[model samples]
Target: MEIIQIVGLGLLTTVLVLIIKEQKPMFAFLLTAFTGITIFLFLIGKISSVIQVLEDLALKANINMIFLKTILKIIGIAYIAEFGAQIVRDAGQESIASKIELSGKILIMVMAIPIVSVIIETVVKLLPA
Candidate 1:
């Protein structure tokens, strides 16, 4: 079953990481990164399907599509940035990982500005004199 495959992959990764931990520590680092990315790749399809459902629900609820899409984009960017940062940290590049996280925060704010402006505009329009 799917659970078995998932568990198997995780166990394999853990064992390999342990085995490499004493030898080439850098290989262990790479192994961890590869494992994380592999797991993310497996989940990517499910995430896309869930997003489609969320979009459908938003449409049914008369929610603003642009706002929904913006939120989804922010989620995606955060996930990817976090993954990258973790991988960098696993590779012993803590400083680079922190920089990546900082950049991700800035990018998220930049992406959110338009949505924030739109909300403000809507509020202002509703409060007309």
Candidate 2:
């Protein structure tokens, strides 16, 4: 049922966007954005549930909250970056899309430094000293 709904919505939007693109490019772009937001809205509940499960699992595993949270944030950035890049690419701005992806990667790497340092320090402590 979910697949059916998603496919139906996707097909409907595709037809609508294609038909409207020639007459109103701006409107087509707005329609595409609206459709994307709508789909994201539909998935928000699922996203939250997944986040909660991850948080609980991390807690149970005795993982540091800061590191876990940072990792999740990095993952979120990657996903959002990919989404934005795809949208830009769809609008025929491949160069800008690539830039956006690069920025996301840089941000993720910066955010991961603390976790990486912790890992490195732990490994060093475990070595014969």
Candidate 3:
């Protein structure tokens, strides 16, 4: 489907969310969550194509696959964490959402440590006697 169609679907979902929220709050939340996930799945193909192009460029530039993979993982973590946090906030749990964001940041840093260490090691070895 075209992006305009997706946008129309999103608008319809928003109106439904508001209508259902008053009578059946649980169902409203479930519908909103499902719509968000459905939209994400729909857009995955576009994201994958973009990532493929980036991978080709990185390969042409002789970038390390391990580093590139780690960066992608970090980006994935950030996106998922933000998505979850926004849902939590919508459900009226701001404090919990903040904690989720904090944990995401920590996890990203942990994943990046290996790449940092590799750079440090390379720098150390390059010193001349």
Q: Largest TM-score belongs to which candidate?
A: 2
Per-residue alpha-carbon lDDT of model 2 for 12-123, expressed as tens digits? 9999999999999888877787787788788888889999999999999998888878988999999899989988877889999999999999999999899889889999
lDDT of each: 0.90, 0.89, 0.92
TM-score of 2: 0.92
Error of 3 at 99 (Å): 1.6
As a TM-score, model 1 comes out at 0.87
TM-score of every candidate? 0.87, 0.92, 0.87
Model 1, span 1-129: residue lDDT tens: 766888899899999999989998988988888888788889888899999999999999999898899899999889989989988887778999999999999999999999999889989999958
CA displacement after TM-score superposition, residue 35 of candidate 2 (Å): 0.8
RMSD of 3: 2.1
**Which residue pairs overlap in candidate 3's backbone?**
none
Superposed model 3: Cα runs more than 4 Å off: 120-129
Candidate with the larger TM-score of 1 and 3: 3
Could you arrange the candidates by lDDT from highest to lowest? 3, 1, 2
lDDT assessment of candidate 1: 0.90
